[model samples]
Target: MPDKKLQLDIRIIKFQDLIGRKPDKPFGYYGLGVQYMLSGKPNMADKLFTQALNIKPGYMPAILGKLEVLLAEKKLVSAARLYQKNRDLFSGKKIYKTRVQRITGSLYSGKFFYYYLKSIRSVFVFNETIGALQRMFNADRGNPVVNLLLAMFFLKEHKENERAFILYNLCVNMEGVPDKLRWDLVKVLAKDNPDILIDEKTAALFTTIPEGAVGEPYANFILKQFILLKDTDKINQAFAEFQKNHSFPDPKTMWQYIEFCRENDIWDSTVFACCQKLIDYGWIDRTIAETIVGLKNRKIIEYTRGMDKILSLYGYI
Candidate 1:
C-alpha cells in the first residue's frame, strides 16, 4: 500500500478531477477545499472556497472553510470582516454572535489580540486573559468552546495542566462537544509530564475517550499508561481498539509498541507479527527486529495476526 501522504495526494487529485467536471457544484468545491486545507495548502483552499462561494453565495460550509483559512493565516482583519459580512447567517445564534464580536474586537492593526495577549500575559497582564475567560466561563459554564478556550489558556499561559485537564474533562462530558476539542484535550494531556498523568482519574479519562476521537499517537500514550500500571487487560483492549482504527503506525509509535512488548515480556505471536509488519513497513528498529527474531527462534509461533481475528476477538467480525 502507498504511504499515507501519497494516498492523500491521490485523493486530493481525485477531488480536483471531480470538481473540474462539476464546476457549478458548491459541495464539490467545498470538498476539494477541505482536502486542500487538510493537506496544508491553505492558499488553494481559500481560492476553492471562494470559488464555491461564487458558485453558491451564502454557502455556509464554504463560508466557514474560508473563515478557517483566514484565521489560520492570521488574517484577522479579513476573518473579522468576513464574519461581519455574514452576520445575517449567525445573528440568530447567541454563541456565534458573541464569537463574532470577540473576533471583531480582538483585531488590532492586522493581528489578533490573542497574539499580543499571549506575549504580555506573563509580564504586564498576569491575569488579564484568565480573568476575562473566567468571566466568560461563569456566564456559560456548559459551553464546550468557551471551556476549551479557557482550558487552552490555562495550559499554555499558566502551565496549569491539572486545571486544563479538569476543564477538558468537563468539556468532554458536555453536550455538543466538538471532535476537535476531544482530540485537543488528549494532545494537551500527552504533552504534559507522564508522571503527572499516571493517576487513576487520568487513566480513566484516557480509557473513556470518545470513540474515533483518540488519534493514533494519543492511543499510544494511553497504551503506555496501561503498560505502566501493568494492566494487561486494558493494554490489550486499547491495542485492539487502536489497531481497529489505525492500520499503519508511525515509526515512533511503532517503536513505543515494541518497547511496551519488551518491558512486559509479551512474546506472543501477535506481538511478533506486529513487529514483522513494522519491519515490512520499514518502521521497525534494529533492536525490535532482533528481539522478534529471538522470540521466533525460541519456539514455533502461530500465525494468528490479521484484522479478522482482531475484529472477532473484539466481537466486531
Candidate 2:
C-alpha cells in the first residue's frame, strides 16, 4: 500500500469520483470538503462546504466544517462575527455558547486573546490583556478557555511558572475538552523540559486528548505525553485516530513518533510501519530525521537499538 499521504490522495480522488457519480448527496461533498480542509485548501473546502449546504440545508457537519474553514482563513478575527451570526445555531453547545458570549464578545482589536492565540504576538498592551483574561476567569472559572488563556498569558510572560502550571493542570483535567485547547505555547515550553507541563507519574491519570482535530499540534502533544508515560497503547490509539481522520499526523508528528519510540525503548509494528513512511514530505524529509537525531539524548538501550533497527529496516540507515 502507498503511505498515508498517498492513501489520502487516493481517497481524495475516490471522494471526488463519488461526488461526480452522485452530485445530489451531501455526504460525498462534506467528506471531500473535510479532505480539502485537512490538505490546507480552505478556499476549496469552504466552496465544497457551501455546496454541501446547498444540497442539504442545515447540515450540522457542513455547518461545523464551514466554520472550521472560516476560523482557519480568518483565524480569530471572524470568530466573533461567525458566532454572532450563528448564535442560535450554537446556542445548544454550552461551552462554545458561553465562549462566544464571554471572550469573543469582548475581543480587543479584532482578536480574542483567549480564542485567537496567534494575536498574542501583536499584543503590546500587556496589562489590558491580563485584566481582560483575569476578568474572564473570574466570571466563569469552569470555562477551560478562560483558564487556558490565563495559562497562556503566564506561559507567554514566562514570569509566573508556578501559576502557569496551576492553570495548565486545570485545562488538562477539566470536565471535558470544551474548547479546543491549543497547546502551541505549552509545546514550546515542553520542548526543553517535557516534564514541565506533564510528567510520567501523572500522565496516566490525566484526561485523554479530546477527539476533534487531526494533524494538529495539540494532538501531537497529547500523543507525546503518552509516549513520555511509555504507554504504547494510548500512543497507538492516538495515531489510530489520526489514521481514521484519513489525514493522520503531520510529518513533524511522524518524526516525533520515531524519536519517542527511541526515547521510550519500545518498538512495535506501529514503529515499523511509521519507519516505512519516512519519505519526503516537501517541507520535511522524514527519512533523515535529518538523520538518527543527536547522540546525547538517547534514553534507553532498547530505544537506541530499536531506532537503528527501524531506520535500517526501512533502508534509512
Candidate 3:
C-alpha cells in the first residue's frame, strides 16, 4: 500500500489535473481547494476558493471553505463579515445559527473566548470551550442543542461519562428532540446502566432502530442486556420478534446468546435451534458446533475442554 504522504500527493496531483482541464468549473476549483486545505496550504486553498466564488458567486461549499481558512488564520473579523454576508445560506439551521451566534457573541463579550471557540474545530482545545459552555448551561439549562453539543464534547473529548449522561438525559427529555438523537442518548445511557434499556420510557426508542447497519448497535445492546439479566423470556421474545422482521442476530449477539444458554443450563430446543442457525450462517465453525453439542448433552467436562477455543472465537479472550 502507498504511504499516507504518497496518497496525499497522488490526490493533490489528481485534483490539480482536474482543475487545469476544467478551469471554469466551480466544483473543480472547490475540489482542488479542498485538496490544498488538506495539504496544509491554506493560502493556496484560499486562492482557489476565491476563484470558485468568482466563477459562481454564493457557492455554499466554497464560501464555507474560505470561511474555514479565515477562521484557521485567526482572521475573526473577516470570517464574521463573510458569515454576515452569507447568513441567509445558513438560515433555518438551528445548529449553525447557534454556533455563529456563540462565536459573534463571544467576539463582543470576550475576545479570549471568541478566539477559543473560533479555533475549536481546528485546534480542539476543549478547556476554554467547556468553561464557556458551562456558563451557557448555567444561564439556559433547558437549551437542548447546547446540552447535546456539550454532552458530546464531554463524552468524546473528556471521558466525563456522568456529566455526559446528565446532559444526554436532559436533552432527550426536552420536547421536539429528534428520535435519532434520543436513540443515541439511550445507547450511551444503556452502556453505563443497562437496566435502562428495559425501562418503559425507552421502549419506543428501541423500536426506532430499523433493520440493517443502523440497527446493529441497538440490537446487540438489547440482546446483551437480556443475556446479562438472565431474562430467558425476554430473550426468546426478542428473538422471535427479530425473526418475524427477518432480522438475524449479529455474530456478537449470537455469541452472547450461546454463552447465556450454557450458563443458565438451558439445554432445550431453543439452544439447539440457535446453534443450528449460527452454524448455518457461518457465524460459528465446526469446533464451536461440537462444543454446543457437548453442552446440549450435559457433558460438562467435554464442553469445558473446548471453552477456551469457543471464547477466543467469540473474542471474549
Clashing pairs in 2: 288-291
Tens-digit per-residue lDDT, 109-152, candidate 2: 23344544455565564555566656656655654435644664
lDDT, candidate 3, 1-317, per-residue tens: 99877888898888888888988889888888888888889999999999999999977778778876875565544564576567677454655544543332222222444555555675444565566566666766654334655664544454535666778667544333444445556667767787766664454333234233234556666666667677667687777767767766776677677777766766655565566566566576554565465654674333333544655676544
Estimate the TM-score of every prediction: 0.41, 0.41, 0.40
Model 2 scores a C-alpha lDDT of 0.58
Candidate that would win on lDDT: 3
All models: lDDT? 0.60, 0.58, 0.62
The candidate with the higher lDDT, 2 or 3, is: 3
Error of 3 at 167 (Å): 7.0
Tell me the alpha-carbon RMSD of every candidate. Answer: 12.9, 13.8, 13.2
For model 1, name the residue pairs that clash: none
Better of 1 and 3 by lDDT: 3
- What is candidate 2's CA lDDT for residue 308? 61
